[model samples]
Target: MILVTGATGQLGTAVLDNLLQHTPAQQVAALVRDEAKAATWQAQGVSIRVGHYGDPASLDRAMQGIEKVLLISGGGEDDALQQHYHVIDAAKKAGVRCLAYTSRALKDPSSLANHLMVRHFQTEEYLQASGLPHIIFRNILYMDTLPLFTGPTVLETGISLPGGQGRVAYALRSEMGEAIAKVLLAGTCDNRIYHFTGAEAYSFTDVAAALTELSGRQVAYTDVENEVLAGRMRERGVPEVAIERTIGFMTDIKHGQEDIVSSDLATALGRQPASLVEGVKLLYKL
Candidate 1:
């Protein structure tokens, strides 16, 4: 059976949704911290395995009888890297045939986002050294995060950030999940790395134009200094740590570290992935 961790989260749930379309639910198992939260999946005939990345014994039990596993990155918490190590060890101990990990797309090692991505890089290195056949999906920034980054008042406030004119090949999270599910269903132990990115790169200015078309408003983009944006965020009660992370991502974008475009996602889905306008409409409910 194939097992998926973090099954209740958006990406994991999407993977299961697509997986069940072409495979029997009995052949899939979901790993979650709370079985109560997975009642719906359990009702749908998927085996629910209670586990957590921080707890190796639970993970070992969860991996039992599972031929392939997808290890979704843990949500940012203290000791997150250690948590991933625990999961990798458990998967190895259980002799899983193949393990897939969702990681971020390539970025410059000296980029500002390095602090945020260090764990992913470390995990990739560790996974490679484990001697287990694996698939590494280097996913780009999700189009789903546009809403959070732009904020609710972006239409009114215009697109003001420190991202400059840098472009990002943003893929929809659901589509990424779909692609991942396809690979899992193929059951290959190819030990390959896939860069899951959109076919086209788009800048914040492109986002502004897309919003203008969808919302019928004259939305505009303004590239401000990092400090200026940080000041605005601070005034709005944004936490210091959050402000730092936001600035780091924007700085990386400004440096063109996130502008890489690739067709890996489309190849996996057997079609071109959604465009910026399409993603905007779906995300903004336009």
Candidate 2:
């Protein structure tokens, strides 16, 4: 059976949904920390296995009789690396034939310029050394996060961020999830690394223009200093780690870390990925 970790999460749930379209529900198993959150999966005849990255025993149990595994990277900075190690170890013990991971798309993942990139690189290195057949999806920034960065209403406040003229190849999370499902269903280990990115890159300036055209309102892109934005996020009670990570992402973009475009995502789905404007319109109902 194909087992998916973090099955209740947005991307994981989307992946499972797409996988179900290609294969039988009985051929799928969902590894979720909370069985309560997986009621829908269970109702659809999916095997619900309880597991957490922090608990190696639970992970081992969750991989029982599973041939292939999709390991969605865990959240948070603290202990996330260790948690991934735990999962890798358990997967190794369980004799899983193939393992796929969602990782950051960086030219040199080993460069320690950003903490998030560093963690992903570390995990990638560890996974490579584990001797398990693996596939790595080096995913770009998710368009789903656009709503979060845009704040409550883009039409009213416009687009404001610390990134300056930095372009991101942002793909819809659901599309990327579909590509991942295709990979899992094909069960191919020949292609080790795949960059799942949008067909084009866009900056906040482009975002503003698109919003203006879509909403028929005068929207603008305001560039704020990193410190100023971080301070504002802090004043608004955003967590310390979140503020730092947000600022770090903007910094990475400014340095051109996220300016990448790839057509592999389209090739996997056998169709073009949704454009940014189309995704935004659907997201805001514009």
| CA lDDT scores, all candidates in order | 0.91, 0.88
Regions of model 2 farther than 4 Å from truth: 110-113
Candidate 2: the clashing residue pairs are none
Instruction: Please report the candidate that would top TM-score against the real structure.
Output: 1
**Tens-place lDDT digits, model 1, residues 125-216:** 99999998999999998999898888899889889988999989999999999999998888787999999999998999999999999999
Cα deviation in Å at residue 17, candidate 1?
A: 1.0
Per-model clash counts, in order, read 0, 0
For candidate 2, the lDDT comes to 0.88
Candidate 1 collision pairs:
none
Instruction: Give the range where candidate 1 is weakest over 10 consecutive residues by summed lDDT.
Output: 106-115
lDDT of 1 at 60: 90
**Candidate 1 vs. truth: CA RMSD?**
1.1
Best-fitting candidate, measured by lDDT? 1
